[model samples]
Target: MAEKTALISLNMGGPDRPESVAPFLRNLFSDRELIRLPGGAWLQRPFARLMARLRAPKARRAYEAIGGASPLRIWTECQTRAIGRLLGEEWRTAVIMRYWEPRAKEVLTHLRREGVKRAMVLSLYPHFTAATSGSSINDFCRHAVRFCPELDYRLIHDWFDWPPFLDALAHLVREALARFDGEQRHRVTLLFSAHALPEKLILEGDPYLDQVRTTMRGVLERLPEYRSRSRLAFQSRSGPVRWIGPSVTEALDTLVDEGVREVLVVPVSFVSDHVETLHEIDQGYRDYALRRGMTRFERVAAFNDDPGFIRAMASLVASRVPASWRDSRQNENGAPCQGTP
Candidate 1:
């Protein structure tokens, strides 16, 4: 019998419904890997619960703005199916959301039932961070050891500057640019926005900022037309603690100072549509840009289920699959394996 193989995509999950918002926040805050409680590890849960209660109303409103729930799980399901098709019949693909229902425990249980012997875990986050990829991978490993110790696992930590991934982004940028007329195209500033993390993470030597910068460089290298007109900014910063510099808001202000009237926002950090993309970027930043006298402000859609992105993800997975278990099918029947050479 062919060896049973499983591919797992790790992500930071959001609430699927309005009611789940508070609980989701609670789960997110409770994770020590994300934010440490002021008191002690023992107080983490209580503090998280309290903070969740306080933040839920605002979070719910954000979710309400974007069709009552996050579109992340929906997009992730489509992505998994696309990748599964690419992987052919011998392999199975599963999504593990760190703070949501389809979590590591459930994923491991399902994989065990499927008789999976080898697993290739892929972090959906192109850039690695202790809060996101680190937390998810650590949670999965701890559970896998306790629940499915026999399972063999391989992890692709980060594919930040992967060629195919950059290709997909460049394609999206070109598509976004096409929306403007020729006269306006030259004036459109390509703002590459990534989620903001606390400055302390960079000070502590987290590779996320460096990887994000590299990813930006890679994507810009693929689009010479936008290199001089492009800028990188951080977004979705919360709380009182100082975060990264040149935030999306501040970046927009600078554009206003430079008399840039048109902007095309590209969310480089996120692959799927979520509150960050929908509410934050679309509603929040668009409004900010317009009120600041920008005539045109549009956001490039997330690479959710895009064929090139799916192909890139498939290639990433296939590269990690043992040669003995690699499926021989190709062309019309299977996805082409294309990645960074």
Candidate 2:
């Protein structure tokens, strides 16, 4: 273990075991930052438990469809380790998942034990959103104040346009397109699907939608060959509130009606394989599109520690990591704290 510094990657992790699904959902719904139920904060935990109990069966089926559990932690572990190697030996790394195990308290405890004086915090979410990235950062900060109050930390935010990241997207797009015959390739509609955010959040000034669009523009610019054929749509929408759209379903409908026969789906927002990519898009939407009149439907391979993406993380760290981090934790007296955790 490296004592100099630790690189911690944050993500919306999933249940990797069969029994964890319900508890995972409960943990997720409890985060008021992400989903706000009809009740006030007082009822958030109770509501979360109820929601999780009600939805767990469906969620479990989805997990079972994707090989019995979420592979997110595996992917995140691979990514963080690869990135740490690229950043050189002085830096140790860990994955601190939101709404799952290896939580902030766990990671911070390990870092403290390793005598890590500094930490470089990076979010797996490339797009900045209060619900996703913000929640993760806040969770880490809250835990740090108690478990590692003196630890120096710096946050690395959105890197959606990091050059190597765009390169990775273009490469995946080309790979997916290659599956089609030359003539059919020309006809394939590129459907870039991003996770949906609540419309209320966007209205309240979350830049996530705009950032997603900008990322699309970046990738399309790199692969101008598919620029005209590409379409952007949102996915994984749930709850009673309106979400950003047109949804993946609506987009497919228009494509099918427009006489588009082949579609190549891209999981634009996620950096790794999880339920969203493996189950939601692969099993759910793929079946939906085929049943609704699409001859062929396919999704691009997830990044999942792809060499280019790891390089992108390295580059982002090199460019953005501060020489020293500011300690966000406070003393027992509620004043500025000093030293490492």
Work out the TM-score per prediction. Answer: 0.93, 0.93
lDDT of 2: 0.86
Best by lDDT: 2
Alpha-carbon error at 214 in model 2, in Å? 0.5
TM-score, cand. 2 vs. native: 0.93
- State the lDDT of candidate 2 residue by residue for 134-211, as single tens digits: 888888888998998878777776777777888888898888888999999989989999999999999988889888
Stretches of candidate 2 above 4 Å error?
A: 1-3, 324-341
Taking the tens digit of each residue's C-alpha lDDT, what string does model 1 give over 1-341? Answer: 17788888888889999999999999988888777646888898888888899999999999999999998988887898789899887778888999997888888988898899877888888898887778888888888887778887777778898899999999998899899999999889999999898788788888889999999999889888888999999997765467887999999999999999999998988998999999999999999999999999999979998999999989887776655445543323221211111
The whole-model lDDT of each prediction reads 0.85, 0.86
